[model samples]
Structures are given as structure tokens and as C-alpha cells.
Target chain A: MTLPPLLEQSVAFLLPYDFSPTVLLVCAGAALLYHRGWRRTRGGWGQALLFWLGLLGMYVVLQTQFDYYAQHSFFMHRLQHLVLHHVAPFLIAVSAPAAILGAGLPDRIHRHVVAPLRRNRLLGHLYAAIQEPLVAGAIFVGLIYFWLIPSVHFYAMLSVPLYNTMNWGMAIEGLLFWWMIFNLRAPGASDMRHYGYRLLVLFLVMFPQIALGAYIALSNHDLFGIYAACGRILPITPLIDQAIGGLLTWVPAAMMSVVGGLVLVYRWKRQSQQVEQPLSPTLGCAR
Target chain B: MPRFKRYLILCLLPLLLGCSEEPPGGWYGHDITGVMPDLEFNLVDHRGKAVTAEDYRGKIKLMFFGYTSCQHVCPVALSKLAAATRELGDQADQVEILFVAVDPKRDKKVLDEYVTNFTPDLVGLTGTQEQLKAVAKRYRVAFSYEKPRDNGFYIVNHSGAVFAFGPQGKTRLLIDDQSKTANITADLRRLIEQSSI
Candidate 1:
């Protein structure tokens, strides 16, 4: 006999506990690796805080009523996407958890997951190729468009596994994009030009979202049938919710990248200014 | 200005370019428009007739989910909805309130009397618990009945938000339970005008 949907969901999330098993397992794994890595390197509190916060944020985003509400509300679903894509990635990027995570992972898991990607010729080459600024920017922007299609969103909302994959994909990819924008690596390509490329990609990422937000805000019809009939939690209309969600996407979501880009530009200018300049020999001795 | 300041201004220039005209229909209710169409339900109305979504085709359906015995939010909301429709004046005839009872037991007996107190146009629908649940699910409403009290009476907690469906049966907007009568009337007016009901 087919069990009731609500009962099934409660059993999956709450019977054993109020938390998701996936969230618990992931947190456990991340904590283990982070602790192991921290013990080995004695990383500073800033990095530690960022990593933990990212993990915690992901856990909250996954386990909270926000996820449940998202099933019935378009506005909440949009906010969830924003948090997963922008906020989660920014946290992970700031943490710079690569070395710590790699070091912390068990040897077997690391070998199977990390070593293969690093050693495989085709995959390694593909990774190197995508790291190129233009390619990375394209993929990031393309993914944003690809996932926002109504059918794609409808299907993702209906399926648990697909939705989870979408969330994870956005987080990992967005983290990678944010990492590139942060750009703490040794200078490559044209030194100053690389910084410009980072800033350019950062600025470009905001455009499509703003445009999409504008469209949603202006739309007169319910674009997604899934969230259409679900009534409001607050005393607002679906159009108002869509408009608010649109404004949310348009403003803060876009501004975050813009602000990040401005910081990069500031650093670029400061760094260049910090370079030593020689005085004219006739006027004064070179410093 | 310093070059840094100039660059920053240039970066922010794009953000200032987003001025679009206002959308059609200056609405008081939250504009749902063509978003999701409100779902249809198959149930017995107070008059003992099987009413379907198609039955409400030519008039705006102001829907609420509550039991007749609801003591708090439900009564206040139903009264407000009734008042708002009354405020529609001559056009009030174009509006019908559908009171979907979530408490299958208590609601079935008292539903007719509960709704008639508001308006003759108001409809009260009830069915088996499973049938009620299926309709509630369609509308994404949360409803649960409590065990019987010492006096054999219990409350059925349900969603209190009101749905305003256009004459074509599409969900046009959501009305807050706490919204003032004037605002609800204004929204209903706009819905009727826009839908040309």
C-alpha cells in the first residue's frame, strides 16, 4: 500500500530526529576533515570560522522550515536559490578550505575522489581549460540561465534527488566562481589583466539575474504552475510575492557581486600603487 | 574625482538603469494574475448539490478554509470577507464566498448556518476527511483536526488566508485575514473590473 506523503516525509526527516540524515552525515564528515586538517596546520580562527559557518549555513538552509515552505511558496524558493548560490559560495570561498579539506579527508576517499581528478589527463586538462577566465565566466552565467527555465525548475521542485543535486551543483559551482573572483593564487597570464578579468566576470554575473528579476516582477501570469495554487503565508498576492522575489534577485543578489568586484578593483589599484617608484635622478635620488 | 572613485561610479552606473513602467491593473490585493491557477474541488455544497470548479465560472470566488466551530481567526476572516463583498455595492452580486470546512464532523452539520449568517451567496462545502484533505492539498492549505474535548467538541486548525479567484476561476490574489474591509473591497473591485465579470 502507498503510504501518505506527509507521513512519509515526517518519517524521513523527523521520526528518528528533527534533522536530516544527509545533513548530519555531511556535517560529521566535514567536521572530521576540518578538525584533522586544523590539527595538522593550526589554521587561524578566521579560516576556521568561515568553513564552519559555510557548513552550518548549508545545514540550516537544508534543514530549516525554509525548505519546507519552499515546496509551497515561490518567494521562499527564490530566496533559497539566492542563499545557496551567492551566500553559501561566498562563505566557502572566504574559508579557502581546499588544503585543509584535502589534508583532512581519509586517504582512501581522497584517493578515489581527489587523486583521480588531479591525475586523469582529460579531466585535468578540462579543469585547466575551464579555469581560464572567459570560459569560467561563460559556464557560470550559462548555468544560471540553464537552471532558471520554468520546466527545469518545475521538475527540480517535484523531484527530491534532482532538487538536491541542483542545490549542490549551484553551491559547488558558485563556490568555484567566487573563488576565482577572490583570486588569491600566484599571478598568471597578464598579471594586472588577470585581476581585470576577475572583475569583469564578477560584474557580468549580475546582469542576467537583474534582467530575470525585472521580467518576473513585470510578469502578469504565474510562470510556475507548481507554486501557483499554493496560497500565501503572509497576506500577500502571488504577483506581489513574485515581484518581491524579483526585487530580491535584482537588488542584493546582484549588488553582492558588484560589491565583490569593487573590492577587487580597490585591491588592484592599491597593489599597483604600492609598487616602488623611482625618483628622477636630476631632482631627487631614487627611493 | 580620484581615478578609484571614477571607476567605482562607472561600476555602479548599470544599477541605475532599471526603471520600467508599472504593470497593468492597479491592484490592492497582491497581484497573482496568471501565476498559478487556483485548483478546482469536487464536493457537496450546502444545498446538497455536487459543485465543481466549473460551477463558479462566471463570478469571483472568495474562498476560505475553516470550520463552523472555529472561534478565532476563522470567524473574523469570514466576517471581513463578507463585509468586503457587501462593500462591493451593486457589484456584490458578482462575488461569491466559498467556505470550505476542514473539520469534517462539526463542519457538516453547522456549515450551512455558519455561512448563511454572512450572505445567501456564500457557499459552504464539506466532505469525508480524506476528501477534504485532497482538496486542501490541492490548495496547499494546512489543516488538522484535534481529538475530541471533554464536551465532545474539538477545533480544526486550518489556513486562514483568503483566496480571490477571478471569474475565469484563476487565482488572482491572496487576501490577508487582517486586511481592512476597504482594501479588500478595492481589490475585489479591481478583480471584477479587470476580469470584466
Candidate 2:
């Protein structure tokens, strides 16, 4: 059936520019699992909203006509990364969906597949290694530097496979990094025990990002010629685009660190309070 | 000491494998072997004949996207490419420049005359919007048109890159506007020589 013209146009705009089956499958699967879990647990609406918004934000940037703009425009590409690597992942991780996702799995699948995978010694060791606070923090910043190297960026833009790898790498690394920061389990139970160390890592990663962004913004010359080589989608000057992209990389991305630090401080305080009153009968009285 | 030697060997293994010797000097253009897919497209030639990339299989193909009416960039780029091919002397026939026009509305009438003004080795190509979009998407380039003025004059923005492919259609190098004619000529020579062997 034919829809109204305006609705048709909107639908067309939402369609993927370069469709990838893998993106479609992963997003759909996540949405399905989250919905099932949310229903079964009668999850809080606030957390569910954050989870859905984060998932939808990632899918939109990666799969819609937005992807085309991100590819062709420097500023738009930076905006896409801001959402993918910072905003969306942060929201998802902050919602603390791990327990809900675990509950979402069917009993048989959890027993035979998920449980086995989680118990694998090599997998556990690898997870522990990457989640080590210092290593995780380094990887979080290193990936940004690695992909932005002018020579590497040129090839990543020109080649489809390299471009896909760069994007997927950013997204996966963002999830892992933010997950480490925001995991809601007690310090004694989680892989990373020190809230102080996580806070330090958050603060440490900010400087390099600011320096790189300032260098790109303040330079008179174009650092990324790939955007010029492939024509820009918008009519803005190259310098203006570079400046805006640099500002995005500079301000909002670094501000995420401050926000994460605040969350950790709150959690740290609450955990301390819980420890102090562990055996008190009036523990619920505070609430 | 033995363990240290083993660690050193392990570190050096990747360097040894990755640093295979090249000629005295590598091609001036960015060597992009195996990065992009093989050159391929379906479009209409200036002669109104439908053609695919296979039609020009034996020659080194240099493909770029622009409109014929693009006043500055298209002319300068075409001339530089023409000069590069001319520098090849008799071996000039070994190369073919595919100039794909992204703006079909205005280009269709004048594309033949425009390309002929540059070099005989260059072939002007245009196609339906779908076909043009497919080709542009394949190359990861982009093009957009500005709104026309009252007198019907407009501007089109398009990629300034020339993608060079080997005789067998293998992706080879990308020549941007900053590349010198000499550099392009040298890289083309290397591509032609390598393909012949």
C-alpha cells in the first residue's frame, strides 16, 4: 500500500545507505532480547528508556542515511563517533543491563551455550586482561589516535573494508571501555575493585584528546585531506569543517570523563555507607 | 639469554615479513594494492555505446568523477592527466582515462566535445542517475549539485581523486589534486610495467 508522500520520504531517509546484514542482525537481536527481559523483570522505565535510546541511537547513526553524511563530511563523521563511542555507549552502560540481559536468555541456551562460554578459562583470562584498568584505559585512547593518523585515515576512507573495521573497532572499544567504568557490581565482586583507579583513568584520558583536537582545530593547514579528496556532502569550507570536528572531539568527548567521574563518586559514597551499616537493623531506615 | 633471544626473534618476525624489499624507490602515488575492489562499472560512453569495465580490460584505467561544466577543477585535472599520458610518448596508448560525469543533465550534450579538448586517450562517460549513484558509491566518492540561478547556471561538487587500476582491473593507486604530473606519469609507468610482467 502507498503511504503519504511525507511519510514515504521520512522512511526513505531512515533507510541504510550501505546496508550491512551484520549491523541489522546485531541490533535486532539486542532489541529483541532487551524487550523480552524488560517485560519479564518489569524493569524500571527510566533504565529501559536509556537502554532503548542508546540502542536506537547507535542503529540510526550506523545504518541510516546519516551514515552517508558521516562518510562524506568531516564534522558529521565526528558527530557519529561522538554518539557511537561516547553518548550511546555511556547511556547503555550506565543503565546497568547485564543482569537483565542474563535473565533474557532462555534457560536451555543459558545452560548449554552462554554458561559454557562464560566459564571458559581462556575467555575469562582474555576478558580479565583487557578489562585491567590501565590496559582498558590505554586502548580507549589509543584507538582514537590510531584511526586518526592521516595516512591511516586516508586508506580507511578509501577502502570499504578498512572503513568498516575502523568504525566497528571504535564501537566495540567504546562499549568495552564504558562497561568497565560503569559496571554496577560491588568492588569486591567486580573485576576492577578500585573506584579511585577508575576515576584516575577517566581523568588521565582527557588531556591527549584535548591536545589532539586543539592541534587539528588550530592548524592552518588541512590535516585530513581525505575529506577533500572525496567530496564533502555539505558546502562548508574545509577549515570550518575541521574546526567544528575538532571542537566536537575536544569538548563533549572530554566532558564525558567528568560525568563518568561523578557517577563513580556517587557509587563510591553509597558503597561506603552500605559497608558501614552492614549489620544494622535500621539499614532500611536510611531510605 | 635464550629466552631473551626468543622474545627478540618473535618481535622481529612481523617486521621481517612486512618489510619485503621494494624497488629502489616505490611509486610516487599512494600504493593501495588490495585495499579497494577491482575497478568495475556499467555506463554509456561518449559514442552512445553501452560499456562495462571489461571493455577496457587490457589498458591501465584511470577513473574519476566530475561534470563537463565544472569550470576550474575538471579542466585542470583533465589537462594534468592529459599531460601525464602524453609524457608516455608511444606507450600512451597503454592508458585510458575514464571521466565519469556525475551531472548528466548538462553534461550529456557537451561531454564528447569537452573530453576531446583534453586528450584522445580520455573517454567521457555518463549514465542514468541510478547508474551514476552506483558507480559513485562503489568508489566511495560523492557528488552534489547546487541550486540553479535564475539564468540556469549551477555548480556541481564532486570527488577530485583519480583512481588508477592495473591492466587486470586490480586496484593500484589514488591520485589527488596535489599530485604532480611527473608523479602520476611515474606511477602509471610502474603500473604498466608491473602488469606487463
Candidate 3:
């Protein structure tokens, strides 16, 4: 199918790009609140920049050629997964969108939307459970392995219900997992212990991806059969395409995890050193 | 002088050998240099000799999925391949053309004479119905024979693309039919040179 020119397709850049009511409401509401929050919170341009960039990343992944060709190409699909499950989530978390957006919402919307959700004991417990390093890590690790299983992967491409659920599952789980990793506070524990736990979780997550990538890269057969008839644009064989996809998921994804962990360590060290002076207390609270 | 010669020799070795390395980026057909698909087969050739993928390991194999019975695509594709081989001239010995018959039932008896009609060197292979299906599945070659007519001759619709593998036993490329005969010949010649390296 011939696509409309990018100049003509410029209209899709608007949020709620897909007609799903939930995505529309959430994106629209977040934009309004984030705008207000940026102004009200005063002088947090860095945080605002990261948040907007995160949203832009999501829009590109969902609306651009990445989403269109991802169905037919393994490497492109890996790219979509990387943006949604890793990069966008990291940026979104670092921006602390929840706190800023909550503070910025109008009184009635806050009362009806944020207040009730905060008040729900069941949700509070569930959210608290997912925030734990072990639970969050296990759930995230499970999702990575579960989706890539050949039988599961093949059918997910064919079934709409399964496919949508998998996409949403990755987005939500990724956001939560990265958020919990960076925000490692637990009740009254020392920040050192918390940082240690975060570092460990980051290390643990890399193993599964490395193993999955090695298997795919090293395999001689066409593990993903869905692309058996498709891969001729670059005129690649199915096995070659899959190997490239495996490398994308394997090495770069692992490097990103390590980089995130290193940044946390550097920040933690800076905070610990600052604690010797008066400014240390506020530095720890900022992230 | 000895040190300079050693340095020059080390640098030139890779450029000369080119083995255990990738070909240059731009090529005529698909450039799948390292992917090894399931090309295993233990079938009798038209000449009644047992042949497998290993037997053709040292040469570039152009594998086609077609049969002789009800024929337009099969004949055309195979004939073009023969032309491509002739186009290779002196280097033609380095290529093996494999025609795997889709209809094993009727093709078992006629493959030799049929394949020779195009070129004597063109190897025709057929297996039992179960074995043929297994091979077809390996190459992702989907074909179904029509329910046999009263005359007992039915058309077998199959994937007609030709898959080329390098001498290193790695699946390399799918030659496009739209590619000119000379282009196809150049592709095969390149493949032969690439594997010999």
C-alpha cells in the first residue's frame, strides 16, 4: 500500500493518535496537567524536557513507520519493544510524571480521579507489591520470556486480543519496572541498601535477555516462522533477519540497563558525599 | 626490512584470503552470508544416486521447487537457471542446480528425462510423499496437488523461487525472477567466487 506523504501525514502527530478512548483521555489529561504542573512547580525545565521527550518517543514508536513495518520485520519489532519497554519508560520515570501531573490536575478532576485511585486499599496493596524489587523483576522477566516463546510469539501475531494485550502488558510492565528500579525507597531503609537492591535488580534482568539473544543469534533454523514469506525489502533470508533482531535485543538492551544502573550509582555516590554538607538531604529526595 | 615485510604481509593476508569474512555490502540478490536453514535431504536423484545437501557442499547450489507434470513456471524457471549456468562459461563447474519435485507420486519415474531436457547436468530429486512434505516444510515451500483427475494427472502448485547457498553451506540468497539472465549469471559467478575465497 502506498502511504500518504509525510507532509500529508503530519496530522497524526497529535496525541490520541489511535482512536482508543483510554489512550486519548490519558494522553490529553497528562498533557494538560503536565503543562500546568510545569508552570506551577516552577523552574523544572529539565524534568519537563525529559517528560516531553518521553511522550515524543512513545508517539514515534506508535505512529511512525516503526509501528507499520514492525509487523513484517523482526528488527523493527525489536525497535518498537526497545522504545516502549526501555527508553521511553526510563525517561518518563526520571521526569516523575505522576507526582507533577497529580499536583497540576484541577480540583474536581483530582478529587474524582486521582483521589479515589489513591484511596483504594486493594490497588494500594497491589501497587506496593509490584514496587518491590523481587516481585517487579520476576513479573518483568517472565513477560520477556513469555512473549518470545516461538509458539506464543506466532499465535500472538495472528490473534488480535492476544496481540493488544501483549503490547499493553509490555508498556505498563516496563513503566512500572523502571520506576520501581530508580525509586528504591522502602519504609525506613538506608539509601545505601536501597541502591544496592536496585543495582542487583538491574543485573538480574540482563541474564534472560542475553540468553534469549544468544539462542536466536546462534540458531541455524528459522525460529520465528511468521516471517517465512515476507523478508524481501532488504532481500534478507528469514534466519538472517531473526539473527539481526536477536542482536538488537541482546546487546544494546543490556548496555542500556547497565548505563541506567551506572547513572544511579553515580547519583547515589554524589548524594552520599553531599550528606557531609547541608545540601545532601534535598539531593537524595529530588529523584 | 623484515619488520616492514611482516606488517605488509599481515595486512594483505585478509584482503587476499577473504574466507571467514563477509562479502562486500552491495550484491545483486539477497546477501544472507551466514544463515544456515534446514536444507537437509536424503533423496534419490533422477540418475538414481543418493544425494544430500552435503554432497553439493563445495559448490553454489541453486535449489528450485518445481515438478515436470503440469508445467509452465517450473520449465521457465529451470530453463532460465540453465541459461544462467551457461552464462557462467568456464566457471560453470562450481554450481549445482537442484530441482526438487513437488509431486513425488508421478515425478519419481520421470524426473531424470525431464531434468535432462533442459540440461544434462541439472539434478532432479524426488522423495516419498511424507519425505517431500518434510523437505517442503524445511524450505517454507508450500504446495498442494489437486485431487487427481479421471486421467490421474493433477497440477502441483508450489513456490517457484530459487534459493542459492554458498559453498560454506550457509544459505545466501533468493534469486529474483525479474532479474535479467546476465544479472542472475553475475550473481552465481559472485557466489562461486565468494565461496572459493
Candidate 4:
């Protein structure tokens, strides 16, 4: 659907520059105080509420940025999607008060709440979810594939809301899928010492995008329609921006893989050393 | 003349090869992934107060080891971290995120300003070369400095993972390069719960 030009221009103006309005900050503070008392009253409810609030705040900032950047060029629009869906959710997750929530509960109440999560039905479901490494792998790989596809990417660029949905949806869903898989505490078969394996999976996951990037860098063709049309006003060329995106994707992914491999190797060596060494007699005797 | 040549050759051998000894491999705890040695180091914060692994005890710590000059990943990681804390709201009070510069020479005020751009709660740190080496050694985090030839721009090689520590100042988990917020939060949640006395 074609956006009204006036509406598009206004949203475009607001998207890049939108900050957390003063009123929202005050409300967020008030919400914090309101939630503090609830912390003792409910088990995980407070945490869930806080999580939603945080998500809402982020959504506001991201939406504005998305709107602003989407109007200007395809590259900034993609970046907005990157921040909104992938990075934002992850940040929100990191900010979660799991430790506080877990600690504050009384043992009885905690057990009452947590017992259901560990029951056969829940455990069975969780176990199945965590066991499917391919599912997580697919989500990670698929998101990159779908978004990076030239036709699909350009389509999203043309329709701002579609771009928001596709980009953010892929990112959020991908993170959730990976979260379940990587989480050691999740149900399913427990031992996952193959740190190298996990690293390789993500490496393979990123390989296609890198391949796409190399193709873009080498090709003489002007692929992106949006950039091709709006050439004069935009400061940078689409090809250069595309190359930068490709570089961003590959370099960080490669580094993560290498460091992850080193950490894995280091750990495997340590675990083997521990096995070879005699246990402390006192600790063994205590057991 | 023959004796002088031999002496010069002998002197140059240690300078080149000796500096390349691999960093120590042993660390104390199991991080988010595998069992590895806890890296140890001493560096001063933006406030000029010195901090060690000990000082960070009693709180869940998120540590990112990077220099201020890093153009991409470091800033992205720090920005995401700030976003996470902003997302955390009250929960942020319990967490401390630190950015330690691998490049000690240019790190101090520069990193401090850079970090504050992301979040007030974030602390920027640097140290003397000896101190940086010691800290990087303990963490098993690696870094190398490259001198600029023509261009003013030079680069330092450094690790990209953000290490998470439990309340006791023990290394609990590694954030890795992925920087997935959910995975980090999930692990931190588990660590926080497990680490409490």
C-alpha cells in the first residue's frame, strides 16, 4: 500500500530523531515504583510485567527510528530493522530481572511456581524444543536468507511497515529459537560440551550472507531498485552501503566463531585435565 | 669483529622470540560455556578509581574487553548493553557493565567518554601496559598493537566476548561475539540464581 506522502514525510522526520519523550520516562519511573511492591507479592508476574514495559519503551524508540530511516534510504532502513528486532530484544532480555525475581521469592512460593515448569508435560515440551538444534539453526540461517534475498529485501524497503514486520519478526523469532537451544538449563538431553559444534553451526549459518556479500562486492550490476531510483539526494551509493553491510555481517560472525573455537578448545583441555587429576581427598571424603 | 657480530646476533634473538610466549592458559572457573581459567587484571575506571576482580564481587558483572577506538563491534556491544539496562529499568541497579580498553595508551579519557554515550552505569577502564598485559593474561583475552605507517589510523586486535561474573567475583559465563540479549539474560538469570549464597 502506498503511504500518503505527507504522512510518510512526517514519520520519516520523527523516526530518526525520536527520543524517549519526558512523559514516558516519568511513567517508566512510576511503573518501577509500582512494580517494586508487586515484586514481593507475585512470583514471576512482576518480572513479566517489567519485561513488557521495557519492550514497550524500546518499541517506541525503535519504531520512531524505523519510520525515520525507512523513508530516506534502503540501507538505513535495514539498519533500523537490525537494531529494532535483533539487538533490541536481546538487550531487553539481558535487562530482565531474573536473578532478583528468583531470589526474592520464598522457597515455598518459588517451588510452587517452579514445580509446574519442571513437571512431565512442561519438561517433555521443553526437552523436545531444546533437542532440535536444526530448528534453531534453521531460524538463524533462514532469517538471514529471507532478509538478504534481493527481491524480498527490496520489497520490504518499498513498504515500510512490511519491512518492520519482516525484519523484526525474523530477528525476534530467531533469538527466541536460539535462546531455547543454547540455554543449558532448558530440558532435553543435558550434556552439550561441543562448544566448537555450536560455533560452527553459526559459522555455517552466516556463510551464505558472506557469499551474498562477496557477490555484491564483485558484481558490476546495480541490484537495489530503491537506491537506483533515489540516487541523487542520498549521500552514499547503494553498492558501497551494501558492501559495508556485507563486511559488517562477515567480520563479526568470523570473529565470534574464532573466539568461540578457542574458548571451546580451552575448556575441553581443562575438563580433561580435571579428569586426569586426583580429586581433593577431603572433598571426596565429605561426599 | 667476529666476536662483535656474535654478540649482536645473541642480543637480537631474545628480543624477537621471547616476547611471543603464549599467554598462560589456566583460569579458575567455568564460564557460560566451557571450563576455563578466570582471567585476572587490574585497571582504573573512568572515575580514576582502581578496580580488580575482587572489587566486582557481590554483584552480577557484565564485562566487555575492548578499546575505545574500535569502530564497530565494541560500540555495538556497548550500545546493546545500554539498551539492555534501559530495558532492565530497576534490574539495572544489580548489574555492573564494564568496558576495559585493550589499548592502554589511548584508552583513559577517550573510553570514558565513549562508554558514557551508551549508558551512565557503564564504566570505562584502562591501565599501564604492564597492568593491561597482566589483566589480559588472567582473562586469557588477547590483544596486539599495530603501528601506523602512512595513515593516522592503526588497529588493535582484541577479544570481542563480554564475560559475565557472579557475585563472588568468579567468572560465570562468556557473552561471546553473537551478542544475543536473550541468551545472555537467560544465562545471567541462571548464574544469579545459582551464585546467591
Top-scoring candidate (DockQ): 2
RMSD to true structure for each model, in Å: 14.2, 6.2, 17.3, 28.9
Count of clashes in candidate 1:
6
> What's model 2's overall lDDT?
0.87
lDDT of 2 by residue, B113-133 (tens): 887777778899999999999
Docking class of 4: incorrect
- The CA lDDT at B33 in model 4 is 35
| Predicted complexes: DockQ each | 0.06, 0.66, 0.02, 0.01
Clash pairs of candidate 1? A221-B34, A221-B35, A222-B34, A222-B35, A228-B36, A239-B31
Interface root mean square deviation of every model, in Å? 7.4, 0.8, 9.9, 18.6
Native contacts conserved, per model: 0.06, 0.79, 0.00, 0.00
Residue-level lDDT tens digits of model 4 in A21-83 = 443564465446435534663535644564565456555545454444443454554455444
Chain A superposition TM-score per model: 0.79, 0.92, 0.88, 0.58
After superposing all C-alphas onto the true structure, candidate 1 shows an RMSD in angstroms of 14.2
Candidate 3 lDDT, tens digit per residue, A75-192? 7777778888888888878777766776688889888987899899999888989888888988987887898898687556434456567777888898899888776566677777
Q: lDDT of each structure?
A: 0.72, 0.87, 0.74, 0.57
The top-ranked prediction according to TM-score is: 2
**Residue by residue across A77-192, what tens digits does model 1's lDDT show?**
77876777777777767567777777788889887987887789998677667776667777876776676688687556544566678777877777767777664443354346
Off by over 4 Å in 3: A1-21, A229-234, A279-287, B1-197
Question: Which is better, 2 or 4, measured by DockQ?
Answer: 2
Off by over 4 Å in 4: A1-67, A81-127, A177-182, A185-188, A192-196, A229-233, A259-287, B1-197
Query: Candidates 2 and 3: which is better by DockQ?
Result: 2
